[model samples]
Target: MGKLREVEILLNQTQKVRFERAMERLQSLSSTTNNSVIVADSIPFNHDEAFLKGHGTSLVDGELLTTVCGVVNHVDKLVYVRTLRARYKPEVGDIVLLRYSFVAQRQSRWRVDLNSTQDGLLKLSSMNMPDAVQKRNTSVDELNMRNILAEDDVVCAQVGESQRDGSLLARSNKYGKLHKGQLLKVDPYLVRRSNLHFHFIESLGIDLILVRNGFIWVGEHTQSNDPMVVDDEIISSKTRQSILRIGNAIRVLSTLGFTLTLAVIMETFDLSNMENVQIHDMLGSEFHVWSQRGKLKEEHVHSKKNVKALI
Candidate 1:
């Protein structure tokens, strides 16, 4: 309460009223689920009943309990907790955005941060080398290893089979270092897995990568990076604004606990343009109050339709 006051002015009377009502409506629509629980809470399931414990659950003195803070969810006999806010736990084949940690000199593997419990070991032999890095020679020397993946470079890769050494693979041709982008971190739960991760907004000239770990990348759309060409692509002001606009929309949506999909993101981006809101003003309290009313209503309806689908 004290901290929020220092950041900005509170909402005015009318905006406050509207915002409160919208919050009520939003909560009411989602109130059906009573399974959200926290750590050390005893689940109200019969101890005698045959039940299989899954992730986020533990047996404490023969009593089933949650080991983490998340919602309790079950699929038939298998019960697990769906974490709302937690450090990323990498799964098999998950497309994750990574930050370069360092190159392991002796092991000949690049260590990358996955926002997980352990840093992933990426073997030099496993990944298809990026075009941007000109190898000094075939040997994995310290100088050339730095040239391949410099310190603090952002990378996009896939989680491989969890090895004894926690090896992460980047075998796909498309998986490589990401450039010309803005990375936005949000709650991992808000981002659902999509059929395709890379998308191009033809109208805005922006490429949106929906990473599974909740690091959304919005950048200028480019098919390939040319090693020979100089890295001096000057983006027009309009395209730059489009990138910022889309990036802010993702931030605002995620802040509001809105389910982030490509469709809803475009809607939010388009709404800001339609209303003539400046890029900087998108994060203002007034804009937040104004945007949620209509968007929440639309999402509520869409969720219901999805629930009705038989197939």
Candidate 2:
């Protein structure tokens, strides 16, 4: 777990011991090397071979040194440090959750806050028109950009490349303005990039978008449509409860610094139901401890299976 200061205060003596043991087990299971370093620390390098320093590293005093605090990584001849607490770094093809900040007239793009250092650009050309027609965006369309996605609307989009000037280009069809949903923010590192970011829970009829930028959206499942077109279907009370339950599962996993995955989320949901724990009570200290213990037990069983297979 990254920073459990808030969680630590809520745990009792036995819970604290159990939590510590689970964290120790997790740390032992991590594949990351012991090459963690801080700023200005000289990184041991191969002097004989030419090595390229990547992000979070700098050349100083004829030695390669780290410029950020993180674990060291190596790829071929390149060495880089993966910073632990930096803002989201947009990568091409990453799914991100953003809030529409404002429309930028200079570039004819909509500025969206992605919880990153630089706001991303959702260009008029990137979005699908209201009529689902693919054509050139005229000046009239540019004028009506606000009507398509107004200021303060939260959207899900895929990262296109950075423009010449360094602004990120965002494009999407399935992703656009989100509605009738709850947006939850978590540490970006917790979200592992995978083939599918969009998940439709068939049983609950809820849509879950696990953005690479650490924004999770839980809402009633709906077909992709233009933001201007609204869905008239009403969400049932049962579906609403399911959505909240899933959202709370995400929150608990995030708080525990567990990796967010569809399997893990579904396990948490199933655990809640099996234990007869209400959605509201999932956030309680006891349930948090219990959840961690459950995870630890699962991991132990998985490790035993791996060992047996090797034997």
Q: Write the per-residue lDDT of candidate 2 for residues 1-311, one digit (tens) a residue.
A: 13322322586744565456445534553545567665666788878999998999999878887877667789999999877655788887777888888988665788888877777777877775668677888888888888888777778777776644324433335766788788888888777767778777776778888877878888887765565467878888999898899899988877776777776777888789899999999988777778877853323222211111100
Model 2 RMSD, rounded to 1 decimal: 7.7
Clash count for each candidate, listed in order shown = 0, 0
Each candidate: RMSD to true structure? Answer: 8.2, 7.7
Model 1 poorest 10 in a row by lDDT: 302-311
Q: What is the TM-score of each candidate against the true structure?
A: 0.71, 0.72
lDDT of each: 0.70, 0.73
Residue 184 of model 2 has an lDDT of 89
Tens-digit lDDT track for model 1 on 1-311?
A: 00111335487744564445444433443476667665566776776678899999988888777876556778998899876666677888888887889887655788887766678777776655655453543564544667777787777777887655766766665677667777788877667776678777876778888877877888877666441222468877888898999999888777676767777887788789889999999988777766776554324334211111110
In candidate 1, the residue pairs with backbone N, CA or C atoms under 3 Å apart (3 or more residues apart, or in different chains) clash, namely none
